[model samples]
Target: MHLNEKVIVITGGGQGLGRAMALFLAEKGATPVLIDMNSQALEETVRLCHEKGVQARAYIANIADEAAVEEVFGNIVRDLGAIHGLINNAGITRDAMFIKAKDGEVSKRMSLEQWQQVINVNLTGVFLCGREAATKMIEGGNEGVIINISSISRAGNMGQSNYSAAKAGVVALTTTWGKELARYGIRTGAIAPGFIATEMVMSMKPEALDKMAASIPAKRLGEPSEIASAVAFILENDYFTGRVIEVDGGLRL
Candidate 1:
């Protein structure tokens, strides 16, 4: 994938790592198609991409909604002609311990709502968007790429049963899609990021942030640009498929 003048769709392109990826790819001559629920943020991202001297468009859609996703992809192809790549970067975390006990007396447990919300947005959303993107790519007869954003916590982290399960499922989907979609010139890959300095993470207290940084072997939070670079690598490398590139600063849970 040369990226030049290619149409790349990025979910959650309103901010953070998604915004970084859109800008980075825009610099490489790719026209970014941003999907997010935040219309204002999406507008800002599109403006930034345009400032980079590339055409960009934004769509407001709830990716977890099947009909909405299908319609969004249909609109993209209708408006843009074809999709060359998709980055399944939209996700949410509803963190809670599976069981919380004090002195052997159970006080709290992860709620079904919490679990379902994460699974719906993170796991199912990825599946829906990936399916639609692949369908569009095939129909247009374009070779494309799909990249799912996983996390180090996919290995199972405390107070994150829902998130961990969803992310783990994302990796499984990546592997499965890589195998099934290869015959169609569509590649699939995943990236598991460590602690990154997104706006939400950077808002933590200084001491808390310091503690997190000290735990990673790299001794610092990752930059959003670093993750964007990994996304670019997976897009440009023809042989990289069905494998996850961990950008975790040597940290494991």
Candidate 2:
């Protein structure tokens, strides 16, 4: 879609892929309504978008909170008119082995907190934001798109049971929503990225990061802009729906 003057809502738009997508979309002339729990980070993203000549706005809201999401989307529509798209990118990772067996003595298991927190934000948050965005799109009587950010870990990455499960759920929701929302002219799609060179991934040790890069057939971590470009393709290609665009560098679990 030509994003000129279009209003797109992006969750977790403070930094990393979310921030990169926001800036790229803004450069395409879309008015990005950025949402994140980090007020300072959100504001910084907005400033960067503004500097790029887009009227971007930031809202501090927890996507997992239904009430907060509703209120924030409401304010977004009030401030920016109709919502054209939503990027469900807000997520967190609390990686842990499902069961740590040390010398056959059952050691540590993934905590309830770890599992619940990941599910709450990664899965539930996507559902909440997609639902709200679809509602507003249908109510406004406009065709729209929803781009969900899944991960290559959805294929069952080691030490990421919680994250993997949640991302798999995201993929399921993407196709389900695509089939269900097509009648309403709202297309849904997902992007599964592998080892992107974001801040979080860069924090790993050099050896570990090098190992990760070597594992990918592309011989490097994917760039945030590449993922953003995939999102744009999904939006512009009206015939695309109910499918996942894997942006992984030919990596298989």
Candidate 3:
């Protein structure tokens, strides 16, 4: 699907990978429709897109809320006339061991709240937004693409049971939606990113960051633009569906 003039919805478009994607698509002539809970950041991203000389708009909504997701997509189609793509990039991390023990005595465990919060936002949010976007795309008679942002942690990281589970579930949804939505001219894909230099990651201690960089075969963190490039490749490639592209700087968990 050519991005020119296409209306693309990006969840978490306020910053990080989402912002990178919005700007990249804008550069390619796509109209970016940003969905984020951060009003100020959303406004800033929209302004940046405008500076790129492309049409852009921002909606403050929690993708995890079913009603909000439905209403937001409805409004996008109502206002934009159509939606050609959606990027499920909004997610959160709640890192905790499933069970933490010291000297055979249980010290702590991942709280149910932690598990539920990550699942609600990372996995369920993707489902809600993807469903609404596909419905709108079908009704508008526009072929569309949905991209889910998974993570290398989906393979299971030591301190991130919740995050890992949610990200892995995202991939499962991508595969199922790819088959189910294909008849409606909708394609589904996922990206599993390794450690990227986003605000959250870069905020880590210098020693920790150095250790992380050393662990990756590339000896560095990935730039947000590299992940954006993968997103663009998925958007532009007609046959790339039901698959995940990894942009992890040669890092594997």
Which numbered prediction scores highest in lDDT against the true structure? 1
TM-score order of candidates, top first: 1, 3, 2
TM-scores for every predicted model: 0.99, 0.98, 0.98
CA displacement after TM-score superposition, residue 27 of candidate 3 (Å): 0.6
Residue clash pairs of candidate 1: none
Collision pairs in model 3: none
Better of 1 and 3 by lDDT: 1
State each model's CA lDDT, in order: 0.97, 0.94, 0.94
> For residues 1-253, what per-residue lDDT tens digits would candidate 2 score against the true structure?
7799999899999999999999999889999889998999998999999999989999999999999999999999998889999999999999999999878999899999999999999999999999999999999999999999999999998999999999999999999999999999999999999889999889999999999999999999999999999998998898999999999999998
Off by over 4 Å in 3: none
Write down the TM-score for model 3: 0.98
Model 1 error, position 225 (Å): 0.3
The model with the greatest TM-score is: 1
* lDDT by residue for model 1 (131-172), tens: 999999999999999999999999999999999999999999
Residue 33 C-alpha lDDT in model 1: 98
Model 2, stretches more than 4 Å misplaced?
A: none
